[model samples]
Every structure is written in C-alpha cells, then in structure tokens.
Target chain A: MYAFNYHRPASLAEAARLLASNPEAKLLAGGQTYIPTLKQRLARPSDVIDIGGLAELKGITEEAGGVTIGAAVRHAEVAGSALVRRLIPALASLAEGIGDPQVRNRGTLGGSIANNDPAADYPAAVVGLGATVRTSKGRAIAGDAFFTGMFETALEPDEIVTAVHFPKPEKAAYAKFPNPASRYAIVGVFLAKTASGIRVAVTGAAPCVFRATALEQALAASWSAASIDSVTIDPSNLNSDIHAQADYRAHLVKVMAKRALAAAG
Target chain B: MRISMTVNGRAVSGEVEPRTLLVEFLRNQLGLTGTHVGCDTSQCGCCVVHVDGVSAKSCTMLAVQADGCSVTTIEGLAQGGKLHPLQQAFHEHHGLQCGFCTPGMIMSAADLLQRNPDPTEHEVREWLEGNLCRCTGYHNIVKAILAAAQTMRGMAKAAE
Candidate 1:
C-alpha cells in the first residue's frame, strides 16, 4: 500500500471537518475492503481518516418501533447482540453469515452499506427492512435510495454514515446461496412482512440490491412460498460473471426467494 | 507515525509508515514471525490474531489502527514454556501437513473456543469457514479443534 497520512478523529465533528478539508481523503472504517484496494493500488488517497474510533458512531439502541445500530458497530457485535437477536433475528442471522468470524470481528455495518458492494449481505437487510441511514450531514436516506449502483451510494464524498435505523418487521428471514470460497452471496433473498406491506429484496443477482415487486405482490396476496412459484425474474439486467451466469442467477433469485419465504414462515 | 500497543503482554512502540499492515509490523518490525501470511487477501485466515480479545485478520488492519490496543499473536498462545491445549491437540491429531496455516488456524480456533467453549463438530466446521486448509483436507484440523475444546473443557471442570 502507498504511504498516506492517517487521521483518527475523536468526534463526528472532527471527522466531518477532516473529510471536508481533505478532498483526496478516504474514510477507513473496518478497512476490510479499503486495505485490499490500497494494496492493489486501485485507489490513491492523500489522507485516510480512520472513523473506527468515533464515539458518536457506536452502540445498538432499541427505540419505540425500530432498532438503531451505530455505524461503527462490528458485524460480530450485531450477530451476538441479545437485543438484535430478540428484535430482528433475521438481521442477526445475516450478520452471522457474513465473510467469517475473523472478518466479522473487524468489519462494521456502516462500512458495509457505505461501500455498497453488490454481493454484500447487509444491503439485503437494509433494503428489505426499509431502514433509514443517518449521516454526519444530518440527513436520513431511505435504504431504497441509499444504494444507487454497483459500489456506488447516494452519499456525498464528505458525508459520514452515523447509524442505520431498521423498523421492526412482523416476520422476516434471509436465505442466500453463498459462494463457497468467499461466503459472499451468489444469490441471496431477504423476505420481510413490514407495516407497509410485504418486501422481497434480492442481492448478489444484480448490480445493486433490488426489490422483486412481483414476488412482493404475490406474497402480499398470499404469504406462502408456493404463491411465487411462477414468478419469473428477468436475466437481462442481472449480474453474469465467472461465478454464475445471468440466467442461472435469475433462476436462483426465485429459488432463494422461495427459501427465504419458507424460512420467514 | 509513532504508535504504542501491548503485544504478547509486552508494551511495544514503533514508528511506522501509515500503510504498514499489522502483520507486516509483527513479522518484520517486531520479529514476531509466528503469525504467517498465507493469503494477503482477507479470505484466508493465515494472519488471524486476537486484537482486544477478538480474532481479526491482521493483514487487513493498518498498524496505526492497532495503536493502544492489546494484541495476541500465535507466539503469545503458549505460557511458561508450555504449549496451549490447542497446540497439543493439533500435534496429536496431525492437524497440519505443511504447517504453513497452523498459526492462523490455531488463532482462529482459539477465538472460537473463547466464545463457545463447547462446540459441536458441525459448529467447529462452520466457525472455521474462513480458514482454508489446502492440505490435510481439514478433517484433522477439525478433529484437533474439537479435541482441544474437549481438553480445555475438562481442564476448566477440574479447576472448578
């Protein structure tokens, strides 16, 4: 990795100030993705602002109708949190299934959604549960609007994600056909019955997490896996790479959605 | 930049480049070579070490990030010239072939045992998803971890 100035800001205000001042700076949360990108020389930044130590972006709180998870909270903490397990077990299970135990120990929720990797697991939860992303700029982006494209987000260059608020769903479950080698989702689906209606979010099959409106509508009519048996996913826009062909991914989307629906029951 | 931290129960300080990884600092700067680097990518667990009592990939973490933190590498597992129980179990079960992945495998297993003292065979396999053992087919590695967990549990029961 190339040499750069490292800054560990103590507070959110300091972090925002540093970000605004350093145009060529990158925020380092877990460094799970950033470190490797640096090692490969994919990115060169004048400064690296480490936000893992920020006190304001830490903790898991249960509010009136939802759970607020601090941005810097590690995956292991979320997977093991009793409050999370009791409130949103599906989210906890998703966290438990991320990269690995070692990766979970360091990787943070804020970093995952902020980076917005196409194959990441948290995106499924964030989008499926219709969560709200709080930022250092004091704006809350709806989860649906947060992820824009592959490795892209609706976040400004200097905006820092502070927390994610997920409203408790009536019933929710996630099922993924994980890549055996890396544990990333090859085709994953998160099914949720929220106050608004039924939600069916699919990840790893596309460039970004997307709601399967057909599956959602089918499930809204009948809350059963069999209801979506004939729901067909279009393969033209899905991801086709060395891991899986787009047609195969489209097929897996339906299969995974059924599995998630079954699990949610 | 200058950073200070506790490694293997010893307070250590060093001046390093901002991009230096924790594994590089341990192996090159501090001469604690027990921590191996099999795959620099986060997928491999060869560089697993306990940071603040949790297992993490040292290669993916910057040395500056570990500042003021307590770190335990493979070299720190044994105490008073005695091997940790996991080490003994690996020896008996022939858990490794090339021994290239032993340090990380042991460290990752140590973290698992710390959190779940009594893990089933399936649980051991699940917890070791990040650890890749090309040789020995992971059968012996899994056996070694389960045996070590049983031995550690027995030791704890005896003390109680």
Candidate 2:
C-alpha cells in the first residue's frame, strides 16, 4: 500500500467533512476488498478515512418492526448474533456461509455492499429481503435502486453507507454455490418477502445481483419448491467468469432458487 | 499511530505506521511471531486472533483498530506451564506436519470448542472450513478436536 494520510474521526460528521474536503479520499471499512486492491496498487487514494472505530457503525439492533444493522458490523458478528438467529436465521446462515472465518471476521456489510463484488453474498439479502441502505449523506436507498451494475452502486463519491435496514420478512432463505477457491458465490439466490409480495434475488449470475422476475411471479402464485422447479431463467446477460460460464451460472440460478425455496419451506 | 491493546493477557502499546496491519503489529512490533500471514487478502485464517473475545483475522484488521480492545492470541491459551487441551490433543493426534497452520488451526478450533463443546463431526468440519490445512487432510485434526472435547468433559466431571 502506498503512503497515505489516515484519519480516525470520532464522529460521522467529521468523516463526512473529511471526505468532502478530499474528493479522492476512500472510506476504509473491513478492507476485505479495498485493502487487497490497495496492496495491488489498483487503488491509490491520497486519504484513507478509517471507519472501523466509529461506534455508530457497529452492532445489531432488533426493533419492534424489523432489524437495523449498523453498516460496518463484521460478518462474524452478524453470523453469531443471537438476535439475528432468533429473528432471521436465514440471514445468520447466509453470513455463516460467506467465505471463510477470516473473511467473515474482517469483512463488513458496508464494505461488501459498497464494493459490490459480483460474487458477494450480501447483495442477495439486501435485494431479496427488501432492505434499505442508509447513507451518511442522510439518503436512503431501496435495494433495487441501490445496485446499478457490477461494482457500481448509487453511492456518490462523497457518501458513505451508514446502515442497512432489513425489513423482517415472513420467511426467507439464501442458498449459494461458492467458487471453492475464492469462496465467492458461483450462483447465489436469496428468497424473501416484500411488501408487494414474494421476491427472489439472484447474485453471482449477472453483472450485478438481480431479481428473477419469472421465478418471483411463479413463486408468488405458488410458493413451493415445485413452483420454482419449472422456472427457467434466460442466460443472455449472466456473468461468465473463471468460476463458471453464463449458461452454467444460469443453470445454477434456477437450481439455487429451488433449493432456496426448499430451505424457506 | 499510537495504539494500545491488551494482548495475550498483557497490556501493550506501540507506535505504528498508518499502513501497519494488526498482524504486523503483533508479529513485528511486539515480537509475537505466532501469527502468520499466508495471503494478503483476508481469505486465509493464518492470522486469526480473538478481538474482545471474538475470533477475528488480525491481517485484515489494523493495529490502530485494536486500540482499547482485548486480544487473545495463540500464545495466550496456555497457563502455568501446562498446555491447553486443544494443543495437547493436536500434538497427540498428529494434527499438523510442517506446523505452518497449527497456530491458526488451534486458534479457530479453540473458538469452535468454546462455542460448541461437543460438536458433531459435521459441525466440527463445517466450523473448520475457514482454517485451511494443506498438509494434514483434516481427518486427524477433527479427531483431535473431538478428543479434546471428551477430555475437557471428563475433566469437568472429575472436578464435580
């Protein structure tokens, strides 16, 4: 990593102010992705604003309606959280399934969502569960609109994700086939409830995580394993990386969706 | 950066560079060479340590990030010149060969045992998926952890 000025701000406003001051600044979260990028010299920011020390950015909160997770909370904490296990075992299981223990211990939700790795696991949950992304800029992003493209989000350069609000779904599950080496999802599916109806989000399939409209509609009619078994996804725009081809990923999406439905049951 | 952390039951402080990782701080600054850095990416558990009682990878975390936090490393597990049960079990069961991954393997297993004392074979295997052991095929390591669990259980019963 190149030599850069590091700032540990005690408050969010100060961090935001620091970001506003330096347009080339980067917010340092879990560093699962960013740190490696920095080491590879892929990203060389003049200022690194370390967000790990911000107390407001950590912890799990379960409220009367739903759960609001501080963005910087570690994946291990989410996986082991008693509150999450009781309310959303699917989310806990998903966290537990992400990468290895090291990745889970150091990776943060804010970092994962912001980095938007094509194989990441959080995008599925954020989309399928109808979660909301709250930013330090005081803006809230609906999951659908939050993810724009591969590694691209609605976040502007100066904004930081402060928290993620997961609306407690009636039932939900996430199933994924991880790239054995990187532990990234080869094809992942998240099944959950939305205010409108049931939603199924697929990640590691396309340029970004997306909802399978056909599967969602089918499952809406009959929320069952059989309902998803018949749904065939089009593979025109899926990702074909080293893990798998577009067709293989497409096949995995359907298979994972059925498994997710089965797990949800 | 001036960082202070309670490491392995000792309160230690060090002035580190901003880019210094917690693993570097522990191994380089404090001369606690138990932790190893296998991959710069956080994929490997070779740098795992307990941060405030929770197992965390020291490589991905910065020393400055650990300020005021309590840390327990592989060195902290032993007491009074006696080996930890996990260490003893690993030693007896041939849990490692080159010993490159033993510290991390033991660190992660200690955490798993703390969480679930008597884990099923599947549970042990699932929990240990994070700690990769290239040398040992994990058969003996699993046996060791299970044996350690039984030994601890016997110790608990004997004390009663």
Candidate 3:
C-alpha cells in the first residue's frame, strides 16, 4: 500500500471538519474493503481518516419497535446483539453469514452500505426492510434512494453516515447463493412482510440491488414459495461473469426469492 | 506516524508508514514472526490475530488503526513456557502436516472457544470458515479443536 497521512478523530464534529478540509481524504471504517483496494493500488487518497475510534458512531439501540445501528458497529456485533436477535433475527443471520468470522469482526454496516458493492448483503436488507440511512448532514435517505449503482451511493464525500434505522418487520428473511471463492452473493434475495405490504429486494444479479416488484406482488397475494413460480425475471440488465451468467443469476434470483420467503416464515 | 499498542501483554510503540499492515508490523518491525502471512489478500486467515479480544484479519488492518488497542498474536497464546491447550491438542491429534496454517487455525479456534466454550463438531466447522487448511482435509484440524475445547471445559469445571 502507498504511504498516506492517517488521522483518528474521536468526535463526529472533528471528523466532519477533517473531511471537509481535506478534499482528498477518505473515511476509513473497518477498512475491510478500503485496505484491500489500497493494497492493490486501486485508490490513492491524500489522507485516510480513521472513524473507528469515534464513540458516537459505535453501537446498536433498540427502541420503538426498531433498531438503530451505529455506522462503526461491526458486523460481528450485529450478529451477536441480543436486541437484534430478539427483534430482527433475519438481519442478525445476514450479518452472521457475511464473508467469514474474521472479516465479520472488522466489517461495519456503514462501510458496507457506503461502499455499495453490488454483491454485498446489507444493501438487500436496507432496501428490502425499507430502512433509513442517517447522515452527519442531518438528513435521512431512504434505503431505496441511498444506493445509486455498483460501488456507488448517494452519500457525498464529506457526508458521514451516522446510523442506519431498520423498522422491525412482521416477518423477513434473506437467502443467497454465494460464490464459493469470494463468498459474495451471486443472487441474494431479501424478502420482508411489512405493515405497508410485501417487499422483495434482490442483490448481486445487477449493477445495483433492486426491488423485485413482480415477486413481491405475487407473494403479497399469496405468502407462499410457489406463488412466484410464473414470474420470469428479466436477465438483460443483470450482471454476468465467470462465476455465473446473467441467465443463471436470473434463475437463481427466483430460486433464492422462494427460499427467502420460506425462511421468512 | 508514531503509534502505541499492547501486543502480547507488552506495550509496544513504533513509527511506521500509515499503509503498513499489522501483520507486517508484527513480523518485520517487532520481530514477532509467529503471525504468518499466507495470502496478501484477506481471503486466507493465515494472518488472523485477536484485536481487542476478537479475531481479525491482521493483513487487512493498518498498523495505525491498531493504535492504543490490545492485540494478541499466536506467539502470545502460551504462558510460562508451557504450550496452550489448543497447541497441545493439535500436537496430539496431528492437526497439521505442513504447519503453514497452524498459527492461524489455532488463533481462529481460540477465538471461537473464547466465545463458545463447548462448540459442537458442526459449529467448529462453521467457525473455521475464515481459516483455510490446504494441507490436510481439515479432518484432523477439526478434531484438534474439539479436543482442545473439551479439555478447556473440563479444566474450567475442575476449577469451579
């Protein structure tokens, strides 16, 4: 990795000031993806701000039938949180299944969503559960609006993601057919039954995680795995690679959606 | 940048480049070579270590990030010249052939045992996902961890 200045700010205000001042600075949260990118010389930031030490950005709070997770809260913490287990067990399971134990120990929810890797699991949860991303700018972006494209998000360079608020659902579950080597979702699906209606989000099969409206509508009509058997997912815009072709991912999306529905119950 | 951290119960400080990895700092700077770096990528767990009492991929973490933190490498496992129970179990069960992945395998297993004292065989397999053992089919490695867990549990019971 190339040499860069490192700054560890203890407060959110200090972090905001640092980022605003250093236009080429990048916030380092968990460093799971950032560190690897740096090692490969894929990115060159003038300064790397370490936000892991900021106490205000590290926790999980359960209140009013929902959970608010701090940006710096690690995936392992989410997986082990008793409050999350009791409130949203599906979310906990998704956290538990990310990467591996060592990776989970350091990967943070904020970093995961901010990076917006098409294959990441958290995006599916955020969009599927209709969660809210709170920023340091005092604005909350809905999950659907937060993700822009592959490795892209609505967050500005200086805007720090403070927390993610996930409203507890009646029932929700996520299922993924992971690539064996990378453990990234090949065609992951997150299905949720909310007060508003049924929400189905699909990840890894496209440039960005998206809502499967047809499957959601089918499942809303009949909450069964077989309900979406006739829904043919369009593969034209999905991702294609050596691991899986677009057509195969389209097929896996349907299979995973059904599995997620079965698991949500 | 100058950073300070507690490694293996010793307060260590060093001036390093911000890009230096924790594994590189331990192996090259501090001469704590027990922590191996099998893969530069985070996929292999050969560089696994305990940072603030949780298993983390050392290669993926910058040395500056570990400032003021408590770190425990495989070298820190044994106490008073005696091998840690996991080390003893691995020795008895023939858990390794090349021994390249032993340090990391032991560290990951130790972390698992810290959180779940009595892990089932299936649980052990699940927890070892981060650790990759290419030499042996992970059969003996799993046996070694289970045996170590049993011994540790028995020791705790006796103490109680």
TM-score of chain B of each: 0.99, 0.95, 0.99
Ranking by DockQ: 1, 3, 2
- For B1-160, candidate 3 gives per-residue lDDT tens digits of 8999999999999999999999999999999999999878888799999999999999999998999999999999999999999999999999999999999999999999999999999999999888888899999999999999999999999999
Say which prediction, candidate 1 or candidate 2, comes out ahead on TM-score.
Answer: 1
Instruction: Write down the worst ten-residue block by lDDT for model 2 chain A.
Output: A98-107
Look at candidate 1 and give me any clashing residue pairs: none
Best by DockQ: 1
Per-candidate clash tally: 0, 0, 0
lDDT of 1 by residue, A175-239 (tens): 99999998899999999999999998899999999999999988888887678886778899999
Provide the overall lDDT of each model, using Cα atoms, as 2-decimal numbers.
0.94, 0.87, 0.94
- What is the alpha-carbon interface RMSD for each candidate? 0.8, 1.8, 0.7
The reply for model 3, stretches above 4 Å from the true place, is none
- The residue ranges of model 1 lying beyond 4 angstroms of the native Cα positions read none
lDDT, model 1, position A126 = 96
lDDT of 1 by residue, B10-100 (tens): 9999999999999999999999999988887777789999999999999999999999999999999999999999999999999999999
TM of each candidate vs. truth: 0.99, 0.94, 0.99
